[model samples]
Target: MGEGLDFAVKYPFSSAAKEILKSDGFSNITDEVVELAVNKIIDSLAGKSRKRIYISGAGEKEDLLAYVTARIILGYLRNRYITNKFAVNESKKVHSYLNEESGETVDRVAEELGIKTKVNDGMLLVPLPVFLKFTPRSPHYHLINRCITNGFVQIEKQEKKRMIEEAVRKHLERVPLVKKPPQKIISAAKKIINELPKQEIQATAELEDSHPPCIAELIDAVKKHQNLSHPARFCLAVYLIGIGLSDDKIIRFYSNLPDFSEKITRYQVEHARKRGYSVPSCSTIVSYGLCRANCGIRNPLNWHKGRRK
Candidate 1:
């Protein structure tokens, strides 16, 4: 719990968040998640805490995505001040201690947020809650944080005692309705399409140029593979994004589909390749069969393995 506990915050504030939240209409789940995320950040930064935060998402997938995004962004802000320039002429003592404890990556994000490191004698620990819609072995549930619902956060011992006492004296305040989960996060994507000016989208894309080349490849692959019109493909794209595959690779794999009965086999192989999955694995073959059955359009190339009798 050393490093993991460190990632949890004394206050879990958002003054140092990297994600910007705005209202836009689109049907993608990710959009609404960004909104809930912003609220959480704002609340945490505003000096608010809940004794028991209950998050009931529509499904485990959405729940995990929202949770992970929140933690990554929150973690970044919390650590930004310690590593980055916080105060002019401040001693480098805190920075050195953090570096010695956590790796540079964690320290860097903290530095960006302007946090100073100090020892806490009595730190509150929170238990992360992640329910599994899929098996615990599944990557999505396994890698994501489950703590949004019933997790305790650390604060100065004195501050914690004061807050607990005040909470007991006064009824725990209910966060505004605005902080509640959206009617539908999927619908928010349409809002993004309607309101986000084309120029701004282009600007964001352009800004991503500095993002790793692998990500660009993954995006390309998704655009290409999306031609198959199978829900499995979209699901696979989501999985690939989780694994950090470049869009270009996704597009390249999609481009390789040929016309014929063997399309499924090829897809099975190609998708596995993109994921760095080995052939014949139970999950890989099962996914391939699902894709093959769903993609009835027939590949144009019609390539098959082995020789005909």
Candidate 2:
């Protein structure tokens, strides 16, 4: 462990960190390196390590450390000693802004950072640590913090997944999309989306009336025997659970769908209920064309605020 830690500190911008930042697959990263990074981050997050390690060199070196640190933090391996002055200042600004508004969206913060606000693409473009490094302390710090915190794990996972997907996409670009059966492609896509990390839903019966238009649209679709998309179904299940719906009641919502499998639906609902998975975001719902209209809000969880009871 000591040897691995020394290797990581000396090669802080090691090949593994570079691959992760470049969205390259973790093919070249050794288990030792990952273990070291994880340990350091955990120590930092637990406040067990308050010793800051300063790396002085060209901007490239610092950038690499920032990238690795960001991944560690996203992986829930955070520690106070792993941060630099710039990161600390930016983090402070972010926490301050979040404290003030308590409702800022990641898209809004990404927009402020001059990042494109496309669903799942915005935050993944820049690693959180890199973003913090470049973004100066400003009045919008709180908003940025909220966005970062909200999707912290997703953003990191997205970056890695996007890299692999991009590679696959490039390799498959030559393959004709029309050649593949639409149902097969759809099934595969659905499986991937459903399997990705989900947010935690704070189930509340009061939020039912405020369900986002997309979610409401899904419920109507389910009732009408119109087959719901995988993401749509997952969102509905999560939303229902969050709103205090029981597993059996949620199973009934999916009973009429063409692809409905009583066993599968029940299992999924019970899993989500037990694990506390959150519903999809407004951007994600919009990406699927499930969004009914622009509600002037960033998160689907907050959609109820704009609706009239």
Candidate 3:
């Protein structure tokens, strides 16, 4: 493999990757590429995707094209859940790859993804504005918690890797939705979409209980960028813990709120779990003004267990 193809195969979202792919002029858009894209999505949700998550290891051309094809699939479907899952996983994959790379390579990838930074006294210094732009909803990363000087946030290698993942996610979220995607791309996307299980399996595969109506309503509010009341948020967090959701997954779900602070979210979820708290009873929820319906269940967990919806 040549230098460009090698880099593109490993980092498909990079400029080198785009340039090499453009040189092929769509010649790589074969049935195999489409099929690879479909299988990748299926595997991703199944919790058994390939290590790279974005790139295929078939060969030089297929490896580079698979990433683009997957993006096309996401664009064609226009599903937020699917897009978010794929982007988050792919970005973390980039972070994992960076873990083994030299500091110079990591810095180069950061630059390619548009995170401007400089090295200062053995630390990577990200500009305040640039850091603010890419920091996720996590309070742990906000400048208030970081070391700042000369209008820059000082970071070590590990923090830079994480910030790179957010940068990559931001890039992938803008899936290139063309007026007309290739027929093969659409067909593959539809086939994959059809194969999705009847009950929505979250990317983490742990929201098996999914949501009762009331919890779903709260989720809708969060997704709409509305801030939840403390009571509502506490109720939802405890309910999620009562189910099988890991603390990390619950934190990610809560990250959608308008004013998400990872520090507070982690504390609330962990504190609720440690105390063995249960979801409030239906009557208590009503008192909090969160009960969405008079469903006959006593609690959210009882929504489907010998009870009404």
Candidate 4:
């Protein structure tokens, strides 16, 4: 691999990554590529894909092609749970890699993605609109909560890196549909899908009917296999714990998330429980931009307090 394309291999969602794929004319689809792609999908479901990818110069093409192949297989399968999980997992890997990247490298990656970011007065500034576009899924990055001067948003490097996760997610989400894919691709997808765990959900211990409208909506998202915003996830977990739900059942409910990771979930849940955290007030939830409705209650817990199911 050329040194110029090295960044692309590391940040495979970059334009250079696409150019490399197009320039290389990748069509071999040998057993090695297929197997690697299969494992990529399986690792995603197994909660093993968050670790960043590594590649030697000699192996860059194989590594690059493997990612594309895995994405194509997912597109062909057209499974929402698998697609969203894979994108989130891959974006997380990008977020991990970005933390160690140099300032120049970070700016270059943003430029490649057309994010129009720059440094001024020792602060990294992003165009307000661009920042808002990618940060909708992340509440802390919500524009109204951020510091703005003139028309740009003042963001720390960590927040910039956080934006990349959403950018990468949207980029990967647009994988062109695979039509009439080769039998090799079809077979590989089947194997990948077969290996996916069937949700790993815990025993049913939900109290949804008794939940406030906002909490009820969050529970419904998990049941539908949708991803929650980080704030939303945390709010939901803390509220469940406040309601006297056990660790096991809360973890069980979260298992329905497409990117479910048992260790991480258990750790966060335990940490919150020990802190004796309760659900945020309806006003606080509104500040996080997750208020689902005006239930006329001051707190989520009260909306269902006397209506135990």
Candidate whose lDDT is highest? 4
- The TM-score of candidate 2 is 0.32
Against the correct fold, how does model 1 do in TM-score? 0.19
TM-score of each: 0.19, 0.32, 0.68, 0.83
Model 3 lDDT per residue over 1-309, tens place: 476676677689888887877777777689988887787767655534376443433476685687888888888887665666577667777887888888788888989977878887878798888887777645467456789998999977788788898888778767767558878987887798788864232234454345777898876766653446677888888877876789999888776653456898999899999999989999888876678787787888876565443
Candidate 2 stretches greater than 4 Å from native: 1-210, 305-309
In terms of lDDT, which candidate is stronger, 2 or 3? 3
Q: Rate the local accuracy (lDDT) of all candidates.
A: 0.32, 0.46, 0.75, 0.79
75: Cα error in model 2, Å: 54
Residue range 259-294, candidate 1, lDDT tens digits:
112356356545656676422222442443333332
Q: Relative to the unseen true structure, what is the C-alpha lDDT of residue 136 in candidate 2, on a scale of 0 to 100?
A: 29
- What is the C-alpha lDDT profile of model 2 across 101-129, one tens digit per residue? 32223333333334332336544444455
- What is the C-alpha lDDT profile of model 4 across 1-309, one tens digit per residue? 576567777788777888887887767567798888888777777657534345556466777788889888988988777777788888888887788889888878777777778779888898988887777466566667788998999988887777777888878767788988989999998787566556543436556356777888888778777788888999999988887789998888888887778899999999999998878888999887778788887898887654654
Ranking by lDDT: 4, 3, 2, 1
Candidate order by TM-score, decreasing, is 4, 3, 2, 1
| 41 Cα displacement, candidate 1 (Å) | 16
Instruction: Please give the distance, in angstroms, between residue 174's alpha carbon in candidate 2 and its true position after superposition.
Output: 32
